[model samples]
Target: MNAGLNDLQAMHLRRLLEGGLPLDARPYRRLAEQVGASEAQVLEQIQRWQDEGLFRRVGLVLKHRALGFRANAMLVLDIPDAQVDEVGRRLGQAAGVNLCYQRPRRLPQWPYNLFCMVHGREREQVCQLIAALLAANGLDEVPHQLLFSTRAFKQCGGRYAPPPAKEVANG
Candidate 1:
C-alpha cells in the first residue's frame, strides 16, 4: 500500500503526467517551480512513489501507427480452454506478436479465447506471420480470424480533469 499523498502532491502528480514533462535540460527543477517544491524534494517524492509501486514507470510512449506501422491486425485464436494460457504465453513471446491476451470464449457461435496483435510493413507480411504462428503452434485445425484496423479516431493520454462540465461550472 502506498502512503497517502496530500491533495496538493496528488494534483501536481496528475498535472505532471497530463501536461507532460518539461522540455528543459533540468526538468525536475522546472517541475519543482511549477508545483512549488524544491527539485530535490520532487525527486525524492517521485523516487519514493516508484519504490513503493504507486507508479510503475514514467517514460515516453511512441505512437506506433504514426511510425509507419500502417498494417496492423488483431489475430484471435480458438484454443481449448485448458490450453489457452500456454498458447497465449507462446504467442506473446513470438516476434511481431505485439499484444496477446485472453478473453472469454463465446460458446456455440464464437470460440476464440486467445488474442494477439501483429503490426508489419505490409498486410501480406502480417498474414504470413499469422500463418506461421498457427503452424508453429500446431493450431492449423483451430478456428481463427484476423481483424485489421481500418481507422483510428483518437489516441491520447488519460483524462486529467474532472470532466469539462463539472470543472468549468465549478470554476
Candidate 2:
C-alpha cells in the first residue's frame, strides 16, 4: 500500500489504472480528478508503487492489425543456452523487430528458445526484413522458424484488480 492512501483510495486508483491512463494532455491531472487527489499526489503514488516493484512497466499495446500491419511473424530461434542472451540482445535491437524474448525450449518437439516478433504490411516484406536481420546479426546458421499469424486475436494491457461485483436486485 502507498503511504497516505487508504485502502479504498488505493483500490479506486488501481481500478482506474487497470483501465489505462486517460488519453488527455494532462493524464495525471485527469486521474487526480477521478481519484480525488492532487496531480502531484497521484504521480507520487505511482512512483511509489513502481519503487515497491508493484509493476514492471506501463507501456503501449499496439494493435498491429488495426494499423494495417497485416503480416506478422513470430521468429523462434534455436539459440544455444550460452549464446541466447547475447544473440537475443543483438536481434532485439535490429530494425523491423518489434519484440524479442527468451523462453525455455521443450526437447524433441519445440527446440527454439528465443522468440522475436516482426510485423509488416506484407508477407514478403516481413520475410526479407527477417533475412536481413539474421544476416546482420550473424545468425544465418542458427536454426529457426517463422510462424506467421493467421488470425487476429484480442489484445489489451494487464489488469491487476478483479472487477467489482454487481449488486443483485431483491424480489
Q: Point out where model 1 deviates above 4 Å.
A: 1-5, 18-24, 55-59, 157-171
Root-mean-square deviation of candidate 2: 2.7
**lDDT per prediction?**
0.80, 0.88
Model 1: worst 10 consecutive residues (lDDT sum): 159-168
The lDDT leader among the candidates is 2
Which window of 10 residues has the lowest lDDT sum in candidate 2?
Answer: 1-10
> 1-171 in candidate 1: lDDT tens per residue?
334445686577566756667789998888877777677777777787679886655666557788988788999888888888888999999988987999997788888889998898789999999999899989888989999998877665665544223344554
Which one is best on TM-score?
Answer: 2
lDDT at residue 171 of model 1 (Cα atoms): 44
